[model samples]
Target: MEKTQILPRATEILPVMTAVMDAVDEESGKGQRDEATGPLFSENEPAAEYVTIGCSLKGGYRLTGVIAENTGESSIFIATNGQTERVAKVYHRYKKPKEEIIERIKSIRSPYVIPILEEGEIAGRFFEILPYYKNSDLLKATPLDAAFVAQVVVPQVNAALKAIHQAGIIHRDIKPNNLFFSDDRNSVIVGDFGISSILDDRQSVRLTTASRTLGYSAPETAQGFVSTESDYYSFGVSLLHLITGHDPFLGMTDQQILKVTLTDKLHIPSTVDNTIAQLIRGLTVKEREDRWGYDEVERWCEGQPVPVKENANRVKNIRPYVFNGEEIMELDKLALALAGKWDEAMKHFARGYISEHLLQIGQDLASTAADYEEETNREFGFFKLLYLLNPKAPLCWRGEFFTDLVRLGERVRECLPEINRDYADLLESGALLHFLRTKQLDPAVVDAFARLKERCRTDRNEAYYKMAFLLTGSNLMKWRGQLFDSVDALVGYLHANREGDIDAMAEELVGSKYFYAWLEHLGYGSILKQWRALPYGR
Candidate 1:
């Protein structure tokens, strides 16, 4: 743990503080009010970092620096005494007091609950201070495998929930963004109790507001319902994301998401262990009555058998690519809708090109999706749609990742004429820069990638650029070396780098947000061959 101490050079923050003071002085109470008074945070304006509040913190806590992350509702800042530090979550003025919530949290004594040290009001904004986690939460830095889930997340989360529910408190909001890890990366704590509600002795649904995060919500919860089981459903969604690196309802509208949640079962991939799958299945059950609660969750975490889910979305026939023109199924339509142009996408929509019908379905489905997932799905779909529209388009340049095993120079020499003719189909997917030495890039690959980028939007073109940067700007060559060339080398690197944590290394490799997309965009043959070369963590 890093010793919590104030920045020695207070001079560095003085200027920023001065600017904030000036800005605050100019405000007539509402510094930057919207056209109409927003429902939440009416008495308060957005917090500016470096602007000191009048309220003194309890327990001799003092500001470490001016660096703070502020949203509409609250500002998060680091504060510390000489020996200890904490994250102060200072909220704008609202009806409910922070003291009440603090007491509720304090009542729960669990390893999973992030401990609160102090609570006070600062210039009307209520601030609650808790132990500072060194690394960012699962939102930014998440590393989980089956063991991680079984040992850390599932057990801890359930323990916290058990303690809270026992005390008649329901954590209204639960998601990856709210879960955090300790500096050691061993303890995963659940925090952010901004919307938690205490249940009556009867233990009923307490919250009535429809302000919950989409995609992670239960079917009834999205319709302004909340209960003890609500958190369980949300945790199931979070669990799914932790395991699969994505939410099931990631790219749909709130309404569409609700429909899917109400009607469709979670599409747990066949690859997942039957026990783990059953746990997720029980938790995500559409009916709150059927859903797994703290007891079930705790049992599962303790390696006990739970009720196996009988129903799940079985993939009828898996496609190697998302853009197969063979038939327009649910999956194919999703990919098609992501296409940039209307006409091209509609050309393959349904029988007689009934785009309007498909368009409405797409809109509703997309509306329920998580914002980031929607964006990614849309972009990937567009890329796939483009490929469908023009089979010959060089969506991928000749060289991407480690696509080639044999002579790279000779293959490029052969593919030059086809590339010049804009026949990217002629450029073999297997001919990529596998043997990456320091800055030894083939000009043909560079030219081909540049040409592809010029034709596409900047955001769409970034994947290739990022890949290139990773290859050239970073020391991937020094790290990977001839590991992919031989099973022995791969094993040696794994043994040396991970200390027998091959599964951890595999999780790290696949955990990268860009890995799956890049692998998919790059042909399965070239990189898949190398990926298959590994001895373990396959």
Candidate 2:
């Protein structure tokens, strides 16, 4: 929290330490992959059973190589039966797939869906093995022409969805990573139903909050409502990615993507084929009630006319407000434009250009706009108006976008070197207090913010950093990118890595009252004393 311990210096210490650690690991042969041994196949032995890396499983499978580590639901590894390679998804400690859903999925077999070859518990942690394709996934074969996507991809995935949905399951994870292709690329198989859930009578259920992939997930998924329509939305986004080889929401923060998904329309480029664009529009509709499903996709595939309920949620403005040379008729689109081009929108608002159209929507909005026009802090007032226009939109201040307090803290951390003045200003101005109140947060939460704002006014940088930590709900001590969960762990690490002015490093950390308060809150007073008692003077 000290200004002297800026990101440049703090970040500098870790790479050297990390290099030393890596060298030690290399010399010791630690964390290295073991080469596979044994023939790929034998005429006498069946292909379903074998071993490679000395470790064996309950089934005839053996892990050969790692494909991906620490995914949302599991770690993906390559397993072999000597002759054939298979994908093994080792589930995270508490993220096993529902047995009922898995059984249902297994019963409804389709060529478009990869079957679960084997499943069992290893040390009480669940894992499933499926056929592995050497060609990887649809992602690697993307930027495909419209003809291939429409003629080949659509029908195959549509069949997969029909079977999955008929079995009363919603495959919540439906992005490119889950869609695999045959060697010929003619057949696309949907796999990895790790976070899938059974649908209720209403065809919707609240499921897995932490695992939904951003940009691919439907807007309603943000509220934990998973439905068949949500899957279709993801499929549509996947189609977009296939056509462009670029995620439209790439480089955007999760909160920003959520805002775009909830409030604005998905803009299919005019350059895209008209038919493909129509399909994307129908599938990516913000309103779940109006979004395309199996029937519409089938109809589209059959060269039949599909009725799309476009602009179902658009506000009927008496007269359109023009901005960025486009007529903005919808409240959501207007909010999007205002946030997207904030400075220009602010200038327009100052001239009372938007107030008249706002009056048509609601007197309250018009009045709010009028007040904001004269407010001392135009940025705060304008962003508040933007929020009022679109309640689902993420909170925005000076071009930075974040959904809640946690993301704001993360943004603060990213810019710790030369912290933004707007952050301090916004904290002290009661704007966040008002914003939080609108969300109907607990009274205690509002009271905490009020108290924090008072503290922020004193030592601007130190107090702001404290507020950032509070917002993030993080106690992890970060050295460069390395994280330590507790004072004991951090202190122990420092002790082990004590070289080159360890006292100076200890002295710098102890100087921050912010660090003291954090350690005290975690009840690490004894550990703090021990840390200070190190040959270093405190």
Candidate 3:
């Protein structure tokens, strides 16, 4: 091994070229030869204006002048064209053909992978060229700063693996050094497909004569089981590295790293969130059967919600006082009525007539209209305000209010779209009636449910599905038996656009313990069974 140095002009050339030239010069018995015979640049070429940095690694190569050096093991450099930058990885000569690995990597078409440029010998040393990236590895950064690692990197990496596996290629080496970040810092590119194995036409595997980095290699690889799943295990290990900020076998010696990987003693970081930690452990399991396939891993990543910080102590207390006067009065009236002080609440409601408080109350209420709870209110006080204002207000406002509340509940059944009722005001007033009667479901609730169903159909928004399920589940519980007809109608409305994880929805309903009876009444037993059978065991 030779000591690494940063040369002034070395940044101009490919990283692997620099490393190979430096290694040969350091290791060769003949030290600095005349400039004419030196490996870098043509003998007659003038020492270019670019600076060259060099370094030596524990392995066979000495790296001379980094093409691009930031915080990771790989080097990036500009291609001869000067437009696109390429990465250069110079590994020890291996028995497996390099061209085969190059071809396999080139076949993958994911944005997460760095495409190979060209591969050949330069100055008697073999090197591979990859597209140069401008982002730092999550390995060297804190997990807190790399929240995108879990949200973006892991998902994209898993998706890339699925594509690679589909192409029948196994990346025997999957680790932090192989993962690169794109210029924007929002995307990642997996590089260095060295040690990758391409399966033959028959699905049964053939062992490739190659060695992987000690800490990141899978156990079965040691036993010669070189399939796509082995790469999955490596991906799992890479994820662990990102989360824990240390290798799984970090403190262990080389022999120990190899030994513990063969045994079950290797432990994942328990301090990690349980969902992610479990994913890590499952991926690194010695038994191939226990390991998740790339698609399954992708699904798991999809299912995981962003991890919420647990300790509220660090959170800054910054509540904004956002209530308007009308909203405050409405809330006070509701609170008073709920507290059995209906007479005082009614008095406050009537105060608008004498004190000309309607305008102020209306403004205040309008201010609080955005509050989720206030938007749900549907009582007589709300209607009374609307009725008083309808004759003088803008037609759009009055019409919207009317249309939103009609047929809101059984109590306002008379206000529904009958022969002569104003349709807009009827809907609004009905919704308001429903809100007043239930106090749980807001007037906006039904619209939200309708929008959720549309989004599920058109956009497959999972959040919408979850929200709609929650709202319907709550309403079903409140209306149970008494509002069976209405609940059934609402269920039909919700069920029409149901998509994704029905079992999970059932589990959520069951977990709440509020909608179980309603769900049963809705003939959901078989639905629940099928839901439970889905991948998430919903």
Candidate 4:
């Protein structure tokens, strides 16, 4: 069944509404109030103000009409200056744009990249204004012939990618929706750098670990690794959709997509032209090292012959292992299958079927299998086996993917009060501890897990939270749903909101002393003292 459209369409404000705003206040009081009021006035503020309802930005762009609402990261709206219209992106409260990345993007001078006209904070939220392209995004302009994409779209977007790559920015989210047509409607320009990552920066901040758009996301991204090649992988997926006139993974659930795409070869339909197929295949190679990048793509655009490198490491399933009624050739696929069917997987192991097949595949895998066989808890053994099978796959327990140790800690925090069974098993069963030891992570991180493991046995809920706090380290702490990277950030949030409930929650948390002690341990004692002295704390 098709999804019902429950919301109204995003539309421009009618002539009637603007006339009313014009009558309300002629000058509209630009920047007269304190900075705390809202978005700062744009230097190019129009003389006649019409938008009295929506907020205005410091860049002098006033949001005139809704273009897209609640887009997870930001709300898209039409901003105006009376004489011209522009696109405004009002970021969600928790999903603020990284200023460093925004600054880099602003410095880029490329016709292939959509320009950022203005950017600043308004009402404690970040916003960006861009020239409204008359032509809509590439998602709406699909079913184009392979010829046009190869000749026009590829060259333009590749150029944009080249510019951003040189700027040390990895456009993590590159798909049809984020690619827009130029004003002339002849070329494509990349937009929406909100989720892009900046390389080589030790102090870089990421909003979330798994930020890639599924289906288009590179396989390595599923395991929490992304590079310039990752962006090219997404570009390839977008090209597939444009040329094929449909999503390659359409109608498949997210899990189904991940299972197949991550483990199997991308099946470019044989019906596709050989030239276009080669380009798509090159860009979407499963191995990032073998995947085509700027140099290969640029040469292809220049009409020079570009050879697509095959993924030499992709397993050939010389002696396939049958599982869950399917022939599994690769270790990664076997790991996914076993994780999916726990009971069946255990049965296979008990029968010595899995180990037998592993021995056939390789001695190393067979050795890992032998070690897991000795685990008292079969479920925990299964988890260990899965990890051994594919260490690069997200450390999955039960069914969910906790992309990394930090993400796993976040999950534990999210499930406290009634801890997640998978989390409990991983911790209490010593599977996580085993993972920590084998992975050889930072000793401090390992020590944090040891503490977490002991706490799991004691039934102290605070210990679980403490483990989360410790594991998070310099990363943002997921607390009661809100995220805070430091005591100052938490204090700043409390000061700004100041609701009765918020203050009460703050008082309760500070009274517990767990949060206070954690902050102190991190050497934020002076900051904690001031916070406690405030009315929000005990």
Candidate 5:
């Protein structure tokens, strides 16, 4: 036979074929070649001549040519070995140290991690062989497929993480790319433990070096503190990414992401259900002490509660009776009278049937009085009437009333000394003074009013302002009848102050209607209506 010239490509292809032959030859090392067939075995012929004695390798070695392209500097081959004829991965020499590391991992007994089979120098360089995985990396799966991930994959991944932690190893790179499913989709196994750290038996699980994907590391990790809690934080972020199909800290730069994860509080989007949102938020807390532990997480997952935001709109529909306008108005009138609406004293007294709302109205009147300067006197009267009608009004309302009274008393203290004798007597009266001093006016407001009556005989301004303040109540009791004289006096003050500042005067006069009505009920309608023309359409 004439020798044929071989091109460079043909020459290059020959070495790969030779390497495959060499591997196959090593497997049949104990056997002799059959002379009849030369070195080339027939396609359908059984290799009985290549059988080794006593070592019956059941499901024996089947050396097939490299099934995949050599993407790296060397080629990879799939060889079947052992009982099941499981696929074996063969890596060429240039990728040696990593291959050796993979081989070292074979000593580990983790079901979740892929196991290495054999490693040694081949063709003057090192090579490693790992069991070829049947399924793709979890990264290749769509996160949106909830059925596959939540119901199946997630539990397995969680279990795998727990297993890894138990083995005293911290897989610093826990991410989708490192997880894989079995060919039958029956199991999940986490791989690529190259970056994992082995914790010292006595020491806790902690990472000294920062070796995590951005946006998934715990806030503490950014500060160079890594512990088991840090792993929980990363798991939380990973869960968020799976649910949202985007990084939780998306749009953030590496530095920004670290800054926020460490300092800023997290905000879960409204789109997520509350239970899950809260769980994730709890895990991502900036403080490690704040983060939930494994037991807490388990409890939450098992207890599974519906989110608060889901029921937010429904909660707004509930309203109590006190919120009704008609009921509120009735209560307001009563409160106003009790607080001392002297002008409408008789009117309120005749229609009186107090309700809880009435007391609330009294408090409202007091608040309104405190809010406006012009209405201060009128509000004081309303407060007095309320105290007189309902001696048992809440202490809170009474406290507020007394506070307002004290403030008003301070403002008028200098003026009181200059006022006429009648007013001075009213200010000095034992009942009013006692109530003012003791700060306990409940059940004493009536006597206080009587003292006002004796002083009004001479002091017009003091008695007038007092009467105006009391008669502002919308309802009144029998004793309020004495306020008619005071109501008349207050009306005079209103007329004097009315034309000076229309708005201020209007507010003062119209503000007194509650008391005016009470007085009208007591027989002063003519005067009450005359004051009503000031503002707010009476």
Candidate 6:
């Protein structure tokens, strides 16, 4: 929570991380025609079934090298001889485990737990032969039905968690990839204890808060707080994902994910059984102490009624400060309105429109900005700090507007000769911004855009208001030997028809013939495309 530790806002959004290994190609255990015992390994390598059968685990079953990677550290191969089938997980060069914990896992008895058949340390690394259920894993069974999750998945996984916890261990990572179906019924069993830890396993590998595939991780863990309750939170999330097809935090940055998990109320589909919904609610509350422990899960699985109450440990919502002047609160909506893409957001401003706060903030920030000899990221920090200070502040604008202001201002200071061309987009982008800021258009701005003839394009809603104004309602102006006739007749035509039919609007528009299915003309489509870089949640 330290200010120095804070980075850009979550709405800045996080870039996507490197993609995970393609499990699809390797799921069939056929090696996907890859070289098994070579001095090299590739990303496209597939899973093989009958290889690596020669590895003896402390001198026991003959393991096949079905998946022999000459360049990687891990390998998987199935061992079967007419009756028994088991998966041999070979970790080469870099795997560590406490023999005491592995022994405890073997001693714990549970049908929903993947039994460790045998394990051994050949070199510095170790390998374990686990009971392999050839049926399927949860990763393969996406979008499971709600009934299946409540009756089959949740109970079985709860049983597994009970057994693991009883053995004083915690499955730090609980996700689809770590769950497999039992060979007997449609029941699921917990597997992959590779990253798991025993209660006293202090020498264990440090499980980072931001580890890859964190959607199922608890919010506290994402912020570097870890506990058994964190595991319960993750299990709850995994269950939700099974019932619903995707992670709730999908496509979000780490920061954004934290914000959502911490503040937003999670949506449990109404179609799900109310009991199941209540169970999930109990498990996923933000506070660790509020989450359901294995004891509660056991009681539910046993058909005993458990009372659901408001968690005393759950954090209370703190509403953002309300500013007396309403204008500041609605500046974000106004920005969008001014951009001409105002229809969708208008409902939010809710007709109680105000702008005194924005006009004041704009004036103050503009004055402060003038004091800077050179434009820098700090110029924008003022706005961001204002947003943080006033929790009630409307998003105020997509992050793009402030950056565009600085960029355009720099162009003015550069004092480059205006290129003689018609509808040159780059110069026009800046010129249009200047007009929006101060209604009077500068001569240099107009001359810089004097045409050799091409359409200027930008979709930034902030930039569009004036351009939209010129397109929709104004008559053509022959200024300095250039024509502004395209779509310029829109407003007059609308008044003549008295109907604001967008389809009709599209037809009357001129710069380009293309139109969107939304019925908006594409004359300004190219202009909007330029704003795609801005991290607006939508």
> RMSD in angstroms, all models?
22.0, 11.7, 31.4, 12.5, 39.3, 22.4
Candidate 4 vs. true structure, TM-score: 0.76
Query: Per-prediction TM-score, please?
Result: 0.48, 0.63, 0.42, 0.76, 0.38, 0.47
TM-score-superior candidate, 4 or 5? 4
Better of 1 and 5 by TM-score: 1
Higher-ranked by lDDT: 3 or 6: 6
Better of 3 and 5 by TM-score: 3
Worst 10 residues of 4 by lDDT: 1-10
lDDT of 2 at 388: 73
Worst 10 residues of 1 by lDDT: 1-10
Using lDDT, give the best candidate's number. 2
Worst 10 residues of 5 by lDDT: 1-10
Model 1 over residues 1-538: C-alpha lDDT tens digits? 1111111112222122223333544764432212323221122333333435433466677766443556545777778876876777777543234456668788778878887777876654667788888886776654368778777888888887877777677787789878988889888888877767767787576534324566676765533457889899889888777776766776775434543564557788886667777888888887687789987887777778788544345222232323334343344224323332334443333222332233344655333232312333343333333333222221122212111212222233233211222222222221122111112334554555444444334343233423332232221111232312112233344545544554555555444423333333322223334334434213
lDDT (0 to 1) per candidate: 0.52, 0.70, 0.47, 0.70, 0.45, 0.49
lDDT tens digits by residue: candidate 4, 1-538: 1011111112211111222323334657432221223211122322222222377777677778888887877888899877789998878655676788888898899999978888776665677889798788988878777778988889889999989988878889899889998778888889988778887644232222545577798877766567888899999999988888888898986667777567777778987878888889889988788899989988887778987777567644568888888998788888888877777788887777888787766888787787788778877887888877876565666666654565676566565434456666677777777766666556776787788788777754555556655654443554566666544455445545544465355445545535544554445444344434444334
- Give per-residue CA lDDT, model 6, range 1-538, as digits (tens): 3211122222211110001112322564322111222211132322223234565555356665464353233677676544676777777543445577688789889989888887775544567888777776886777888778878988888888888877778777788868998887588888877656566545222232123245566655433345677777788878777777777777776434544454455777877677777788877876676578788887876777876544454222132213332232233223323222223322222222222223344556434433321324332333333232222222223222211222333332232122222222323434333232232234443443332112344333223323322322222332223332322222233334444453433333322212111112223342233223335321
lDDT of 3: 0.47
Error of 4 at 298 (Å): 2.0
Quality of model 1 by C-alpha lDDT: 0.52
After superposition, candidate 3 runs with Cα above 4 Å error:
1-80, 90-97, 142-146, 304-538
Residue-level lDDT of model 3, residues 461-509, one tens digit each, is 3322233233233223332222322222433323443455543443443
TM-score attained by model 3: 0.42
Q: Write the per-residue lDDT of candidate 2 for residues 136-221, one digit (tens) a residue.
A: 98888778889989998898899999899888888988888789988677788898887787876664544433346778888766
Q: Which stretches in model 2 have alpha-carbon errors above 4 Å?
A: 1-81, 88-130, 142-173, 182-187, 191-228, 241-278, 294-306, 316-329, 347-353, 360-362, 371-378, 402-410, 416-475, 499-504, 513-538
Local accuracy of candidate 5 as per-residue lDDT tens digits, 1-538? 1001121212221122223334546887531221221222122322123211222222344545454555343444555664443433334432333333343456557666666555554333444455665676666664545455555555565666666666666666666655667877677777755445565567663434323466676655432345666667766676666666776676775444543554345657787666566767766765576576565565565675422221111111112222213233233223432333233442333333233223344665434433332323433433444444323222112222222332333333324223434334335433244333333333345565665667656764546455433423212221212222233233333334444554453343334523333444444343334333333224
Scored by TM-score, the top model is 4
The lDDT of model 2 is 0.70
